[model samples]
Target: MKSKGPPGGGLVYSTESGRMCPGCRQPVAACVCARQPARPAGDGVARVSRTTAGRGGKVVTLVRGLPLDDAALAALGKQLRTACGSGGTVRDGSIEIQGDHLERVMAWLQAQGHAVRRVGG
Candidate 1:
């Protein structure tokens, strides 16, 4: 059987339903869809802390429990780095900014509607 083109000029194939599950956009069998309830703003608390575990005792502002995916986390990290005028990265579901900018980070997170707390010294 010949395949048909999708609505937007993409190719669509036969023998396939060409329909996607709204939740995951995957075929039904492979779909691991879950309805993500909307979390209230400022519900999750972002904790900031300092760590000196492997970087020559340099202080880092660690932001955790952001409830963001990897890509969003990366973007947030970039924004925080820019705001703090420092370098940072997102790893292990947390954002790590160079230096001890806990207060600044907390303020920023609060501005973004996230409850924040300082965890460690």
Candidate 2:
């Protein structure tokens, strides 16, 4: 059953474009509608915490509230991962480093002259 809205309502794929963005109706590679939102403003401090809520009880350190742009944040996340000798990713303006590296992250951030705060128990 389909309602009478309009013909060719949406284009999901194409031979030329390969894939189309629903929001912009442009090719996936050339789409400008799926831009990432700006990071939330913070108090100029980086908060680090360790949690195991998800990931099958595997501990992961989260660094939040860092006042940095996307590129800089990614670079910092990479450095943090290297410093902790583990793997991780940066997403939604936060850094998620695999394993529990609360102290190491805090120390590194402090050494880099960024105010660090330990969050959670």
Candidate 3:
């Protein structure tokens, strides 16, 4: 078997320190670099759709393929949720708004200059 990191250049576990982060060579608990980068790049085009699968009897509006990164996506989700006066969240780089707000969400995204498309009827 071979070591995952560079030879003799990875984390060192000792009584002095509990754990370490190989990325920043810092303590694991306080390693800022270990956190994933927020607002990662994405593909172009944004699509809106409605689905009720696996969610009991509730319908959720799904918005996907937005070019914006995570921070922007979260902000946009917040705005859309507020606009719809409903609860929603961002999951797996997609915005999931509660209830069927496809028309409302499409209009809002189009107003925001997004190349929006209505998907899944």
- lDDT per residue (tens digit) for residues 1-121 in model 1: 5545444343233258655555555665555675445533334778889898898989888888777777888998999999999998887788999998888888988898877888965
Q: Compared with the true structure, what per-residue lDDT tens digits does model 2 show for residues 61-113?
A: 99999888889999999999999999999988899999999999999999999
Which candidate order results from sorting by lDDT in descending order? 2, 3, 1
Worst 10 residues of 3 by lDDT: 34-43
TM-scores, all candidates, are 0.63, 0.73, 0.69
Off by over 4 Å in 1: 1-43
What's the lDDT of the predicted structure labeled candidate 1? 0.78
Instruction: Give the TM-score comparing model 1 with the true structure, all chains together.
Output: 0.63
Error of 1 at 89 (Å): 0.6
Q: Best to worst by TM-score, what's the order?
A: 2, 3, 1
The sequence of per-residue lDDT tens digits that candidate 3 reaches over residues 78-111 is 9999999999999988999999999999999999
Q: Using TM-score, give the best candidate's number.
A: 2
RMSD to true structure for each model, in Å: 7.7, 6.1, 7.4
The best candidate in terms of lDDT: 2
lDDT of 2: 0.90
